[model samples]
Target: MQIAIDGPAGAGKSTIAKMIAADYGIIYLDTGAMYRCIAHRVLLQGDDFSDTEKIIKLAQEAEIRFEGEKVFCNGEDVTESIRTPLVSLHTSDVACIKEVRELLVAQQKKIAGDQSVIMDGRDIGSVVLPEAEYKFFLDADVTERAIRRKKELDAKGIEKELASIKQEIQQRDDNDRNRVEGPLVQVEDAIVVDTTGKSIDEVCAAIKKYIDEVRA
Candidate 1:
């Protein structure tokens, strides 16, 4: 079985997807990191983020892999490097490119390859895994999502004003929703989970309940 979890930034898709995959003994794929890996490469080369052609080429040529929580790009461990704010901003831009999306989506699908997997990303349900046996769309209010993102950054010792982070997140939402290639959207068959004010375990349990019902 394949499970697809789609959500905007800081909506707990990654955390919940990891939990679900672990509990069910399946592989977990973080599709966002693939884009971030390409962004990281672009930044390393000092290439302009707006250079779509270069970004697409970088994405296609780069080798991306994930093992547990560690991410590797071109055989280099970039688990922490790709999470920088700069890469986060550029990731949205790279992900919006049509060629970049196509390249990464193909790679993501190849990694699943008949295995039971749980994948999470902005467009997983809508594009990458439309036929997934289980699909979920997680969401939270802007304020709540911002708070979650801030906490994550704080843990990494990356400090930014709450208002600034909130604005960036809102901008990301706009970009994801309006992107031409595989725009972020909640497909009709997906289970929409409003994660505002909910704990991670609560959200995981709710999704697991649905999965259990299906299995039953």
Candidate 2:
């Protein structure tokens, strides 16, 4: 079974996906990291982010592996490397390309087909796993999401102004929503969850309830 979770930034898709995957004893795929990995590679190669063809070629050659929480790219461990602010800033662009999305989505579909998997990203529900058994669109107020993102960055020792963080989040939202290929959207059968002020446990409980109902 595949569980597809799509959401805007800081809406707890990743956190919830990790939990649900563990609960279901399934492999968890962080699809966002796939784009981030490509962005990270582009930066490392000194290629311009606007060089879409080059980026696509790089993606084709790239070897990405996920072992639990560790991520490897081309035999090099990049779990920490890809999380840089530079890559984070440009990942939306990388994720928007039809070729890039197709490449990654194909890989995601293969993995999901082989195992019980929980995957999260902008297009998982709509494009990567349209026939998934369960789908969710997680969301929250922009300000709340910005604050949550700030907290996560703070924990990582990455400091930035709140205004700038909010701006970045909004920019990503706009790009993801307006992109032509598999833009971030609510799937037809998806359950929407607003987590503006809810605790993680509360949100998980609600999702679990839905899962039980769906499975029943």
Whose lDDT is greatest here? 1
Q: What is the lDDT of residue 204 in candidate 1?
A: 98
Candidate 1 lDDT by residue in tens digits, 1-216: 999999899899999999998899999999998988998999998959878888878887898888899999989999999988788877888888888888899999898898999999988887888899999999999999989988999998999889988998899999999999999899999999999999999999999999999999
Instruction: Please report, as a residue range, the 10-residue window in candidate 2 with the lowest summed lDDT.
Output: 80-89
Best-fitting candidate, scored by TM-score: 1
Instruction: Give candidate 2's whole-model lDDT.
Output: 0.89
Task: Provide the TM-score for each candidate, comma-separated.
Answer: 0.98, 0.97
Model 2: how far residue 4 lies from native, Å: 0.8
Residue 44, candidate 2: Cα error in Å is 0.8
- Residue 162 shift from truth in candidate 2, angstroms: 0.8
Query: lDDT scores for all predictions?
Result: 0.91, 0.89
